[model samples]
Target: MRDSEKILDSWDAYSDEHTDLDGWPHDDHAYGLRASQRDADTVGAFEPLRYGARHLLATAETQLAQLPENTVQSRWVYQLGVLHAALDRLDELHEQWLVTRDALPATANPGTADFDDALAEHHAESWSYLDDWATHGKALREINTAAHKAPSALVNAPVRRTAAQK
Candidate 1:
């Protein structure tokens, strides 16, 4: 089966496993699992956008190369280049942080008395990285918006709303 299929299958199993509430109104263990899965799903949803950004950044590089050198247009391209560079570095750092976070063991076992402690520690580290990753992603979006508007707005100030307004 495909990777997506595998992911779906795992999700199905997880959902089934968490459906039980035991004697309580809500099963705390299962609820926590569901919440963590939701977080993972959110990150998974954005993976495609991140992948697309990488390709677009490469395209920007090629397009920037073909522009006239030492001109206003070239300056815009240079600004985009700098933004892309910083965004790329952020991506790299996020990946490294995620790798380190995921490398931590989830828990010892069902027999271990310290499972809650271990799991809490794992979540603390992983969620912190996840939050940073999300913030970095927002920065990338802001930089991209700035890049999109920079060509017409950076060197040319007092942009007119319309020909009549100018």
Candidate 2:
């Protein structure tokens, strides 16, 4: 959607209008997922992915808020919050661009293992902004490969996770 590009570009203009946000330049935050190169398929696939990741990160944050500061889960929650906030904006752009796709070849996502693999990379990338850059970075690679081997049944399938996952 050209409008979507304009929206994200507006954010860039917004940043330039102000002094660099926090310690980093507005352009710094503008990195990743350049609008011009993104294909419809990219946007189609990314919309739900960004939405899901953002939602999951928010869930982690809320759960973390309920716990004590010293626990491991809390640590993950805090760390995840930092990571999540870091990538939330990029994911938002994905959501924006992806939502523009309505008529597609399939109703279900994860249309292919390749798509899933891309998502896995994207998910892990979202977490890399926090510390443990090595851990999260590796996770991105691991999941990216694993997603490719996903069962053919998963193609065109709705996301399936255990109840505990929710």
Candidate 3:
């Protein structure tokens, strides 16, 4: 099974045990408003992205660690740096979103119109951070592809003097 399917199954099992009580509605629209609110909530929306980015950063760091010191290419080093920067940006964005969300009044519950309006406002602001994260991710992917294809590209090679200079 796909990883997401497995995760969903696990989640379903857990939810069935924990949330199926108290006659909670199980229809399609039962959690629609709350889900939408989460999608719009800065902290809620970015939490998954932040989690994934953290994993990516860890994987990149592990790969870097496994490379031998003498044979490690500059491109690979650059890729690691890019991953670090991207993860840092994601963290900053998540924190900023959390602050924004926390600043809201306690009355911003999912079903209320005031909360809906707040969601609409925050959603637009959140897009800028999302766009930046996407751009960083794209750059990292491109760098990784290039490094994989040409791991010895001119970055850390020693310069040689020409005959005229010699």
Q: Quote each prediction's TM-score.
A: 0.32, 0.27, 0.39
What is the C-alpha local distance difference test score of each model? 0.50, 0.43, 0.53
Deviating ranges (above 4 Å) for candidate 1:
1-27, 50-127, 151-166
Each candidate's number of clashing pairs is: 0, 0, 0
Model 1: per-residue Cα lDDT over 12-112, one tens digit each: 56666766555332477766666566445544544565557666656666544443343324344455555465446647656665565565467644346
Among these predictions, the greatest TM-score belongs to 3
Candidate 3: which stretches are off by over 4 Å? 1-49, 65-83, 111-113, 132-166
Candidate 1 has an lDDT of 0.50
TM value for model 1: 0.32
Supply candidate 3's per-residue lDDT for 111: 67
Off by over 4 Å in 2: 1-48, 68-70, 73-78, 92-166
Better of 1 and 2 by lDDT: 1
* lDDT (10s digit) by residue, model 3, range 96-140: 656766776798677677666665555555544543444344444
Ranking by lDDT: 3, 1, 2
